[model samples]
Target: MQGHRPSQKQLYDHFAPKMLGVCYRYARTLQEAEDFLQEAFITVFRKLDQYRNEGPLGKWIYRIVINTCINGIRARCRFSDTAGRIDVEHLENESTAHPAAHSEIIELVRQLPTVYMTVFNLHAVEGYPHEDIAKMLDTNVNTVRSQYSRARTLLMKKLGSGPKTNENGKRG
Candidate 1:
């Protein structure tokens, strides 16, 4: 059904759940996620005409949601002094190790600090290159790499994976 057009309601109904999940990954609270969802949908409808069918509608909406979330994070970071200083020790203590599972991984990711979480989600989950991520976040490539590294380290520690090892089983 490439280029098939759907009504606004149809589009919202079809994509809301998945897009809310995307918002939830970036929001610190359920309320914030809902807010992001609402705001993103508003943007989606306003820009509906801009969707040129170059890609799947779902992918297009997903990009809008991600951009909305990133913008939200940037705004929050701008106003909050503690934005980048979330206490890792507290998060680690509150988190539990579970077998590799989708929900478990999402929960682990949610515990990450905002900066690290954004970088991790963009680079690892969304398959964006570090260079692209750097440009998107308006930061240097080295900073993106540092944040991604810290994010992985935090996630591994939270999941009780200790430290990662190289192919030869030596610690990285």
Candidate 2:
């Protein structure tokens, strides 16, 4: 059965916050995320008719947000080689052990190259499979897998390990 068209207000109320959060993870600043969010919503509204109910509405909205973030990254990345380098010193040591340290992780993620950022965000943050990411980016699954591994390595290096404790309450 065909799904009914969702109104702008309805869609906005349902998706804006979560989509903006997705945008924030990839955007360098809140303003940039807002801009991407606006553009993404516009695209979603225009392409709403094309949405098949085969997937959940949240997933469709997520794809639009991811695409929007990728576009923004590509635009800025064309002239910037700086994003490819990982500056481990700039990362906080606590962020590695504490998942609640979002700001530090977000900053590190922002430093990743455009290709890596898109793949990492989709696979790690958004929880999309490598096959889906490859299809979306027009690349092979192996490429996606490699990029994800690279991104994770960079993150681990940047966010360093904390003091190690053994299984029996002994410090290592």
Top-scoring candidate (lDDT)? 1
Q: Which predicted model would earn the best TM-score?
A: 1
Stretch of 10 with least lDDT, candidate 2: 79-88
| TM-score per model over all chains | 0.76, 0.67
Over 1-172, each residue of candidate 2 has an lDDT whose tens digit, in order, gives: 1234456878788889988988988887899999999999888888888988988989998888888887887677642222212333334445565767867678778777667777777876678899998877767788777777766666665666433447894657
Query: Pairs clashing in candidate 1?
Result: none
Q: 150, model 2: CA deviation in Å? A: 1.6
Report the lDDT tens digits of candidate 1 across residue range 1-172. Answer: 2234467678888999999988988899999998899889888988888989998989998999998998889989841112222234433444444334557667778888888888877877788999998888888888887888778777766766557578896877
What is the lDDT, from 0 to 100, of the residue 169 in candidate 2? 44
| Candidate 2, superposed: residue stretches over 4 Å from native | 1-7, 52-55, 78-99, 162-172
What is the alpha-carbon lDDT of model 1 when measured against the actual structure? 0.77
Q: List the RMSD of every prediction in angstroms.
A: 7.9, 8.3
Give all candidates' CA lDDT scores: 0.77, 0.73
